[model samples]
Target: MNDSDDDFSRFAWHTAEQRAAQGDSRQVADLAVELTHRIEAAAEQTRDHEHQLAHLVRVLAITPGHDSLTQLLRLFTRSQGPGVGLAPRFVASLLAEHREAADLVGPLSERDPKGRLDELRICLLHELILRGVDVDAFPKTIDWTRVKYGDHPLVWLPRRRSPLETRVVFPSRAINSSAHPGGSVLPKEGRLDPPTPRTQERSALVDTATLDLHQMIVSAPEAGGWGHSEAWVFRADEEVEPDRVPALLPTLPMGCVEGLGATSRFEIARRPADEIWSLLFATASIGIGHDGAHGAFGRLWAWKSLAALSDAPADASAEEVEHHVQQTTWFHFESDAEWFCNEIFADYGIAALSPDRRRIAVLAATATD
Candidate 1:
């Protein structure tokens, strides 16, 4: 097929996958079953053509390692029909079934078990957060396979757990504020309880783990303005004067706010520290992408502004959040510095904003150096 056809095909495939993930049974069943038949056909053809070394290489070249493995598994259970795999495709299904079952549960015995285990754990954790589970109440551990509901392993549960967890999961270091260990959460009373200051203030950083997207805009305007006309602009560097920008620099700008002229706007209000953490983490993990590595690092750079703030609290008063317009190693595209500012402002509002603190500090440090 041509490039356009290929693009369309990929989009269609991804659409199917997304729907399946969201529990669209019809799409999941149809695609899963159809894909299985294709896989079996390819496998049989490969086996028959193995005698021709050139043909084998060609077959292998066209099939990614992950695709080949998935096909093998799908073929084994073909008799159940195409739609069947959707019901019991992975360990999460088992957990959902027997969340309270009594049995020894462990990660499945699979090739590249570590990778599989991590995916499962992340999925479960995200699932929990989405269900409004207070992530802070449960400390995170890497023992996915060891989980048990009563006596049965989590993988073997007959029914999914009730009351799914809803708080988004993110890397712990992302939420570690200089204010305290494991970071501090503001109570509903609007108190400031930060984590103990870090020994190396220079290293303090904020990221997806410490920010919450939902809470940031729950009652705010739909789009945060960047003092620019372009809707949905997110820039690291721009032509405008630094003083004119209205949001955080060096962070992902909220396109929804800027581009769409969202009616939601930031409000100056006290938010629970836990809520802030959940929003950032959820945005970084879920809203970014399925393969969110680039987004993660982009978030890390955004946190660098926070790090600068935390590093020298004595100097926080002199800093301003800065941005470099040119795309560097952080992200590949051009962004709107103004939009970035709007997102941060929309997230926290202007009353409690601290954009200038980091800017002042950076300038002072540069002068000293």
Candidate 2:
């Protein structure tokens, strides 16, 4: 091998070995990319190319992505010890952050003035909500319109509204004071009557509810599926103290928040709130709606419902709760959501009375209130 090629190979090998030793999966995942290049370069003349390819294959298989990539990096790096270099860690962080942005943006553009301004505000509000922000405290009324693209008249449009931006909206006190904290709109009892299984499968987007809400949210969507790279709407709801935040939503910009029924200038769609809530809640699970019908609204609702329930709390039997509480999956998603929801409710000093108390209070408040 020439000096430069040999130098690249040696550096790649050394970094891979260091990451492997340090147990840095993030580094290892990155090294997987580097090794891809090395394997290509080595393919032309090196006799050891086969061995290198096998090793690279093995590395990719061992790495886990369902869990937080950051956690994966921490565990892998800690296991490998301090001798590992810092370069892989930096690269891993950047790639992960960029991927998250791509997932949220979802083929959106900033070229159109109106679309650009709206997207920016949406992102800014989303950020504020992430930090336990109170948009209600903001003075201006935020207006957003849901636009369709690649559908008839708008097919050639430059900036199209994302399914999400078209659906979720800011909570106005006059409208959504009693809206569900997350995207869920379960009955006052917070219990589903029970879902009867359907016989036929529909479109990939519509029929994707075969898996549980948590599974759908945490797992990657198949090719040409919902096109959602990742779902992170579920935040801890239990930890926020009373008055600290209104609600710790499982997903921010709750999918049901989109398109108010108001006769305002920024009306996106004319769907009703109860209908939107019902459609999303049911579709995420059994994939049904209030009228038990199917439509684009159902699909969108299903997606957000799953995202919301990824953080839904359960009051399981003592034995079941105890057994599940110890499991890694349970600890990560189930418990985390429960704790998050509880914290948010606590922070807001939302009373934790029985369903009877809640129902009476909600009933007492006028629709305007």
What is the lDDT, from 0 to 100, of the residue 201 in candidate 2?
25
**What C-alpha lDDT values do all the predictions have?**
0.29, 0.28
Candidate 1: segments with Cα more than 4 A from true spot = 1-104, 107-118, 121-266, 284-369
Cα lDDT tens digits, model 2, 266-332, are 1011122333333332323122111211222223333333233223234333233223222211101
Q: In model 1, where is the ten-residue run with the lowest total lDDT? A: 360-369
lDDT of candidate 2? 0.28
Per-residue lDDT of candidate 1, residues 54-87 (tens digit): 3332232234344543443333234244222222
Q: Residue 127 deviation, candidate 1, in Å? A: 6.0
At residue 194, what lDDT does model 2 achieve?
Answer: 17
**Candidate 2 TM-score, C-alpha based:** 0.19
Q: What is the TM-score of each candidate against the true structure?
A: 0.25, 0.19
